[model samples]
Target: MNRNKLILLTAVLLLLAGGGWFLHDSGFFQAVRSLEALRAYIAGFAPYSHLLFFLVQFLSVVFAPIPSNIVAAAGGVLFGTLPGFLITFTAVASASLVTFSLARVLGREFAGRIVSKKLSEKYQGVLRTKAPVFLTLAFLFPFFPDDILCILAGLTSLSFRSFALIVLLARPWGLLFASALGGSTLGLSPWVMVPIALVGLALFLLGMKYGNQVEETVLRRLKERRSGDTE
Candidate 1:
C-alpha cells in the first residue's frame, strides 16, 4: 500500500486500541482480563496444553498489556522446563510475526510522525535494508522498548520475508533469556542466564553496528527512488 493509505490504517488501529482500552477499563471486556489471569488454566487440555500454552504466549506478546514473564512461567508449569522453553520460543516467534506484520501494514507513516527527524533519518536506512538483523537484535536485547521499535521498523520499506526470517532466528535467543531467568520452573542459575544475556547483548551490538551502515544505504536508495519517481 501507498503511504497515505497505510497512515490511515494506522490511525484506525490506534483508535481501535484506544477504544479497546476504554472498554477494558469499563468492564465491558471483562473476559479479556480473565484470559490474562495468571492461573494454570491449561490443565483440562493436558494433551494439547503445549499448543495451548504457545497460543496464550503468542497472544500475550501480541497484546501490549499482557506481561510475557507471566506467560513464560505458565509455560514452565504446563509444559515442563525444556518443553516450556521450546514452546515459549515458538509462541514468541509467532507473536513477533504478528507484531512485524502490523508494523509493516500500519506502522510506516505513523512511525515517521512519532519520532524525531534526525533519529528517523539515521535509523530508516537499516529498517529499509537489513531489517532482519536489526529486528533480531531488537528482539534479543531487553533494555529498549521492542513494541515501539517494531512499529518504527514497519513504517520503513522492509520486505516481509526478511522480517520473518530474522524474527525466527532472533526470538529463540530471547526465549533463552526468558527461560533461563524468570521462566525456569526447574531453577536454572543466574550465572548461566548471565552468559546467555552476554551473548544476546553482543549480538545486539553487532546488529546495531551493521544496522547503522544499512540505514545509510537505505537512505541513499530511498532518495534515488524518490528522484526517479519525480522524473
Candidate 2:
C-alpha cells in the first residue's frame, strides 16, 4: 500500500477502535427504544454530536454491512430536515469516494475479496461498457447493491473525478426522503405514512427487478452513440 492509503487505513482502524469503546457496554439497544431517547443521547454530545453523527454515517458506507438508513433517520430526528440531509449526504458521498479509491488503488485482487466472483461476473458486462450514467442510476436507487458497485467501479476505466461527481449527484434523494420522513414533526397518520411506505416499497421492488436491464440498455445506447461519433 502507498503512504496515503496506509495512513487512511490506520485512521480508519483507530476510528473503529474508538467506536468500539463507545458502544462497549453502552445501552445501544435502550437508545433505540424511541426516537426521543436517541435524539437526547446525541444531543448530550452537544456541538460535537453532528461530528459524531457524521462519523457514523461515514462508517456505515465504509463497513458496507452497516445499514445507513437507520443512522440517517436518526439524523433527521436529531437535527431536522435540511441539516440531517446535508450531514447524511456529505458523509455518504465522502465515504463512497474513499471506498472507490481504496478499491482502485488496491487493484482487482482487493476488489475481488470485497465482491464475490459470481456477483462480479454478473455485472461485468454492464461495467465493461464504461457508462457513467448507469453508475449514477445505480447509486440513486435503494435496491441496487451500491457498495458492491463502488468496489466494482474501482476496477473500471472510470476516473476518480467522474466517480465522485456521480456519487455526489446521485446519492442524496433516497436518503433525503427517508430523513425527511423521520424529521417531520407533524404526526403523520397511518393513512399517510402507509401510502408513502407502500410507494417506497413499490419503487424498491421495481428497482430490484429492472435495475440491471436499465443499466445495460443505457450502456448499450451510450456505446452506440460513441461508435457513431467515431464513425
Candidate 3:
C-alpha cells in the first residue's frame, strides 16, 4: 500500500479496535443479543432513542459482526415498523455508502488486507464488469455478505451514483421484512410461524451450502456476456 492508503488503513484499524472495545465495555454487544435488552438500552436514550438506534445500526454495518439485522428488529420493536424500517434503512444505506467510498479511496490492496485474500480474489470480477444485476441480487439476498460486498462494489467501475441507486433499490426489502417481523404486524399463529421458521432455516442452510457456487456462476455469466459485447 502507498502512504495514503497506509495511513487510512491504520486509522480504520484504530477506529475499529477502539470502537469495538468501547462497545464491549459498554455491554452494547451483549444488550443487542436480546431484543428486549436492546430495546431497553435504546429507550434509555429517551428523546434521542431514534438517533441512538440509528447510530448503532450505522456503526454495526461499518464495524461488522455486530448483527445489523438484530438492530433493525430492535428498531421495529421500539419505534414501530414504518419508523423503524425508515431509520434502519437510512442508517444502513448511509453506512454502505461510507464503506464503498472508503474501499474506493483505499484501493484493492487495502481491501485485500481487510477482507480475506481468497474472498477478495473470488469477487474481483466485480471490478472488471458492469454487473449491477449481480450486485442487486447479492444485496437482496441474505445468502451473501452484504456489508463486505458493499466494499467490494467500491472497487468496481461503478460510479457512486449507480451504486447508491442499487443500494437504495435492492437493500430495503430485507430490512423492511426484518422490521415487520419485530413489529409483530405479521400476526401469524404458532402453527404458521413454526412452518415458516422451519422453511427459513432450511433456506438459510441451503444458501450457506451453495452461495459460493451461485456467486461464481453469476460472475462467470456476466463476464462471458461482457466479453461477447466487447467482441
Best by lDDT: 3
The Cα error of candidate 1 at residue 189, in Å, is 11
- Rank candidates by TM-score, best first: 3, 2, 1
lDDT by residue (54-134, candidate 2, tens digit) is 976786675565567767778887788789989998998888888788778767656765678987886666665654876
lDDT of 2: 0.74
lDDT rank order:
3, 2, 1
Between 1 and 2, whose lDDT is larger? 2
Q: Model 2, 153: alpha-carbon shift in Å? A: 0.7
> Could you give candidate 3's per-residue lDDT for residues 21-86 as a string of tens digits?
877877898897787898898898899998888888888876667778778878887888889999
Ten-residue stretch with the least lDDT total in model 1: 28-37
lDDT of each: 0.59, 0.74, 0.81
Q: Distance from true position, residue 20, model 3, in Å? A: 1.8
RMSD of 3: 3.2
| Pairs of residues at least 3 apart in sequence or in different chains that clash in candidate 3 | none
Quick one: how many clashes does candidate 1 have?
Answer: 3
